[model samples]
Target: MKAIVATELGRGPRGLQYLDVAEPVAGKGEIVVAVRAAGVNFADSLMLAGRYQTRQPLPFSPGLEVAGTVESVGPGVTAFVPGDRVLAIPAFGGYAEKVAVSAERAVAIPADMDFVTAAGFPVAYGTSHLGLWHRARLRAGETLLVLGAAGGVGLTAVELGVLMGARVIAVAKGEAKLAVAKAQGAHHLIDAEVDDLKAAILATGGGVDVIYDPVGGALFEAGLKCANFEARALIIGFASGDVPQIAANRLLVKNVDVLGFWWGAYADKAPAVMADSFRTLIGWWQDGRLKPHVSDTRPLPLAAEALELVLERRSTGKVVITVGD
Candidate 1:
């Protein structure tokens, strides 16, 4: 099997090499998937550079989610059989021809969903779903603000926030990206490059009840300033490369709740929550309520380039790496 191997760290995505590697076999309680496509994420670049929270040993692949056909199931695995089409959260090693993952982490994808869409679904949708629905408890008629609203997880948050009946305000870098968010039902679009984020967000709905911020740093501070009393601010990630230090006075003044949500953590700490979240997400897809957007698809050989698209913020929605025909 051919895989993108990271032999060393701190060199970024350019350090990755597409080379022939040993095929993975199903281990106990795991299943081997012949990968059809893999989702590219910003964290892949972070992991490659040794800046992410989770670090695998050297000489590893960096993809976290994949969609493929089941090649084989390990002993004691009865939930999936060979030839099953499913998506798995492998945590690592998804940038390969085949990956072995625990059966518990794999979910059968809807028959109508393509491998490209399925490949990009789990992390972005799962993160927004769990963070907004479970953590923030976003309610209908309430004002919801999504920062970086045209990016992968940010787009999904815009869509879901609208569906959940909130009046969504989308913040993105340009008109092109803001237009994408508008099509997904954002009631208000703020150009982050031109407008004052705090004033624009406050002008639309007085103040936001919940803020979904995946691009931290200055944007987060601006969102915090425009938050409604007792607003729930969800800290999704730091895509801006700067982590903001929140002042204790701000939280106390507004009685706001700044919640940090790490979707991957649920896979290990609370597997049942992850499973239930996927079930709802798949149902929404089947009902024609969810539209997943894949901006670019590259061959497996260009896995590094796919990662680069995400790291450089050049691509909107999700970028996928196709493995085989």
Candidate 2:
């Protein structure tokens, strides 16, 4: 099989090479998938630079989520068949023609959803849904502020926040990106390049009740200052390359809650919750309520370039690597 192999680390995307590799076979309780498309994430660059939490051995493929057709099923796997279309969450190794994942980690993709959309669905959409609904308990009629609103997970947060009945304030770098957020149903947009986020957020709705931040740094700090009393701030990630040091005084004064969330952890800690969340998301997708924004699509051999698009923040929404026809 052809796969993009990462033979060394600390070299960013340049370390990856498209080369022929041994194919995988389904093991017990697992299924082999003929990958159609793989989702490129910011973490892929982190993993290559050796900054991510999970580290693979010397040689590996770097991808987290993928959508494909089932090629084969191992013993004890009855949930899927050879022709099933599904999305699988392999911890890594999705940048390949085929991958073997535990059946429990895979979900059947909706018949109407294309492989590119399904490839980008799980991590980004799942993160926003879980963070806003489960962690923050965002309510309708409340004000929701989304930082990095043009990015992959950020766009979903903006869309879902509005769908859940909150007035959304989207913060992004420029007008082009802000326009994309507006198309996603954001009620208000803040140009992070010029506007004062704190003032703009406060001006938009006095203060926001729920803050969804995937880009941490100055923006996170600014968003914290504009939080309404007892507001819930969800820390999704530090995409800005700088983690914020929370001020104890700020939390005490506002009685605010800083909720840290990592959607991947739910797959192991609470598989049932993960399953239930997917059921809801899929239903929304089926109804045309959830539209995945894939800004770039690259072929398998150009996997490094695909990762670069995400790392450089040049692409809005999600970037996908098309693995199969």
Candidate 3:
């Protein structure tokens, strides 16, 4: 088996060194996945740089999701068999051609969900759904604002917000990204790089009912200004590298709630919850109501280049690495 080995915690190229390794055997209650595709996420870069909250042992793989068939099942596993198609948000070790994961952690892929697309769904879409549906409790006809709306998690929020019947106001860097968000079901767009985000949201609807902010820098502060009474601002990430400080006075004045979505932390404890969420997302995907956009798919050997593209923020939507040629 081959894996994009991260021998040390640092940035890409300096930390990542691909190498061959002995094939893994599934322990009890685990399954060995013949990974056909792997999802590239922002967290992957953070993990490589040792800057993420969750740190792995030295010399580990960085990918958090994978899609493929079960190559083999462990002794106690009964939910699936060899060759069963599944998508998983594994704790780690997804970058390899094969990975061993607990059977409880895997979800059977829908027949209509493509492997590459499924690889991207569990983390980004799942996180978006959990935040919007569970935490924010976003409702129909409400106004929702999504910052960094062109990235994976951000785009998923746009699509899900539309499915939930919210009038989505998307904020991104440029026209190209705004176009992408509009095509993915966002009702309005804000070019924050040029125009003001808070003013745009205020002009669009006076205020938004919910704000999905994946990049928490200046936008976090900007997001606070465009909240209606009881509005929920979901803090999804610090992708912008700055965790903006919030004044309690503003929260009190606006009577708004600041929510956080740390999807990975709930790992083993939230498998059943996430699985249920996946079922709902699957219906949308099948009915054409929920769509995950894949911007690029590079071969496994080109994984380095794919990371580079994501690091540069040049790629749009989800980037998948096809492990099998």
Candidate 4:
């Protein structure tokens, strides 16, 4: 089977090479999926570099979400059958020709969703959905300030915020990236490069009700001044490679709440929350209210290049590697 393996930490990927490994077969209550596409995420790069929060063993593939057709089903797997189209957040091994995953983790895909888009959904958008509605309890007509709004989860925040009737201000590095965010439904765009983000965000709306921050660093602290009183700040990730430090005085002065939203933890603690999120999100998607703006789709051979885009902070929206159809 063809797959990308991170043989060691800090070493980049090697091109696809032939290996006579036996094909994966379904285990008890498991299903084997013939992967059609895999989504490239920052975690893949961090996992390969031994910097991700959940570290896997060495010499492993690092994709978290995969979409494909069911090739076979193991014993006790009655919920699915061969030839089912599915998307899953696997324990590991998604960046391969085939993956054996627990049937309970595989979500049945709609006939309308493309394999690439399906693979892109479960992690990035799912995180945004759960974080916004469940954690923050984002209210309609409230203002939202989105840091790193051009990236996958950031753009999802923009879309979901707008869907919930919030005034959205997208904060990103370049005009090109901000333009994409505008096209995806951001009400206002703040170019963090040429201008002051805090000023620009506050200039549009008097003060933001919620700040969806995925890029943490000095900018995370700088953006705090734009939050309104009793504001909610969602701490999604540190894509900036620098974890932020918040001063106690600022919290007391602003009277704001800092929330740490860990989407993975909810998969076990509140699995039903994700099911409801998917039903509502996909319903909006099917109704033409929300569409995932995929910016790039690279061939399987260029998987490393796909990861490099995010690692270099040069990405806009979701990036995927097509393994098949």
Candidate 5:
């Protein structure tokens, strides 16, 4: 097998090595997948820098989500068999030719969904669906504002927000990115590079009942000023590299709720909720309501370049690495 090995922490993507490695074998209750494609995420950079919440030991792969065919199954695994097409959240080690994952964490992808789209589906869509439906309880007919609307999770938020019947205000850096957001179902688009975010959001009328924020920092502060009374602001991540310091006084004045969400935590604390979330997302996909965007596809040898695309915010939706034919 060939894998991307991170030699040391803080070395960043440059430290990664694409070389021959021992193939992974299925352990008890686990399954070995012949990796077809893997999704690149911002967390991969954080993990390499040892800044992410879930830290792996040195010399590890950084990919989080992948899609592939099952190669083998370990004892106690009955749901999947060899040659099944599935998508999985491996937590790590997805930037390789093969990965060993728990059978419970793998889901059979729709027959019609291509491998690249399936590879990008789990994390970004799962975050938006779980955050909006389960955590925030977003009501239909409400106004929803999404920050970083052109990025991976942000784009998904815009799509799901509209599908759930909310008026979506997408905020991104430029027209091209906003155009992508519009195609994804954003009713209104704000150029964060020029327009005043707070004013742009307020201009949408009725203010904003819910805000899905993945790029924090200044945008988070601006969103607070535009939030409607009793609105919920879901904090997905700080992609802008500056974590916002929330002022409790603003929350008191508007009766707003600042909800922090981590979609990966649900896999451990509430597997049932995670399962249901996937079921709903898959249903939406089958109905043609959900379309995953894969903006760039790179081969395994260029895995570092794929991560660079995410780190530099050059790609929208998701950047996928094609691991094998």
Candidate 6:
């Protein structure tokens, strides 16, 4: 197997090395997958720097989601067999030619979906879907404001918000990125580089009933000031590198609800919720209501470069790494 191995913490993507490694074997209730594609995420960079909530030991691969073919199945795994095409949330070790994942965490991908799109599907879409429908209880006619609206998870929030019938205001850095958000069905686009975010969001009318914030810092502060009465703000992530400090007074003044969400936690704490989310997401995909935007696809050897694109915010949607044919 060939993998991009992280030699030490805090060394960043530059510390990764693409080299031959021992192939993973399926353990009990696990399946060994010959990876076809892997999704690159901001969490991968955080884990490499030892800053994320979950950390792997030194000298590990950092990839959260992958799409591949099942090469072999372990004992007690009856749902999948060799040659099955599946997508998995491995949490880590997906930037490799092969990965051994528990059967319970893997889902059979639709036959028509490409490996690259399937690789990018689970994390971003899952986070947005669960955050909007389950946690925030977003109403169809409400106004929704999305920060970092052209990035991986942010773009999905824009699309889902529109599908749910909300008037979506997408905030991003530039016109190019804002255009991408608009294509995904954003009703309004605000360039955070030039526009005053609070004013731009308020101009959308009725203020914002729900704020889907993945890029925190100044954007979160602005969103707090612009929130409607009894609004819900979903804290998805802090991609801007500065985690905002929420003022308790703001919540009191507006009767706002700041809801923190982590999609990965549902796998253990509430498996049924996670299962239902995937079912609905796959159904939407089959119906052409959900379109996953994969901005860049690179071969296995350029895995580190793909991660760099995410770290630098150079890619619009999801960046995928192609592992095997």
lDDT of 2 by residue, 175-225 (tens): 899999999999999998755778877887588899899989999999999
* Comparison by TM-score, 3 against 5, better one: 5
* lDDT (Cα, tens digit) per residue for candidate 6, span 139-205: 9999999999999999999999999999999999898899999999999988987557777777778
List the candidates' TM-scores in order: 0.98, 0.98, 0.97, 0.95, 0.98, 0.98
- Model 3 over residues 1-325: C-alpha lDDT tens digits? 7898888776574567779988989999999999999999988888888888778998888789999999999999999999999998778888889999988878898787788998988888989998999889999989999999999899999988998899999998888988999999888888877557677778876788898988988887877888889999998888888987899899999889998778876667676777778788877778877768889888877787877777677777889989876
Which stretches in model 2 have alpha-carbon errors above 4 Å?
Answer: none
The lowest-lDDT stretch of 10 consecutive residues in candidate 5 is 193-202
Candidate 5 lDDT at 269 equals: 91
Q: How does model 3 fare in lDDT? A: 0.86
By the lDDT metric, which is better: model 3 or model 4?
3
Candidate 1 on 1-325: residue-level lDDT in tens?
9999999999888899999999998999999999999999988888988888799998999899999999999999999999999999998999999999999999999787999999999999999999999999999998999999999999999999999999999999888888889988889999987557788778886998999999998899999999889999999999998898999899999999999999999999999998999999999999999989889999999998898888887888999999998
lDDT of 3 at 13: 45
Backbone clashes in model 3, listed as residue pairs: none
Better of 1 and 3 by TM-score: 1
How high is the CA lDDT of each candidate model? 0.93, 0.92, 0.86, 0.83, 0.92, 0.92
lDDT of 5 by residue, 1-325 (tens): 8999998999888889998888898999999989899999999999999999898987788889999999999999999999999999987999999999999889999899888999999999999999999999999999899999999999999999999999999999888899999999999989987557787778877588898999999998898899899999999999999999998999999999999999999888998999999999999999998978889999999999999998887999999999766
Off by over 4 Å in 6: none
Report RMSD for candidate 4: 1.8
Worst 10 residues of 4 by lDDT: 12-21
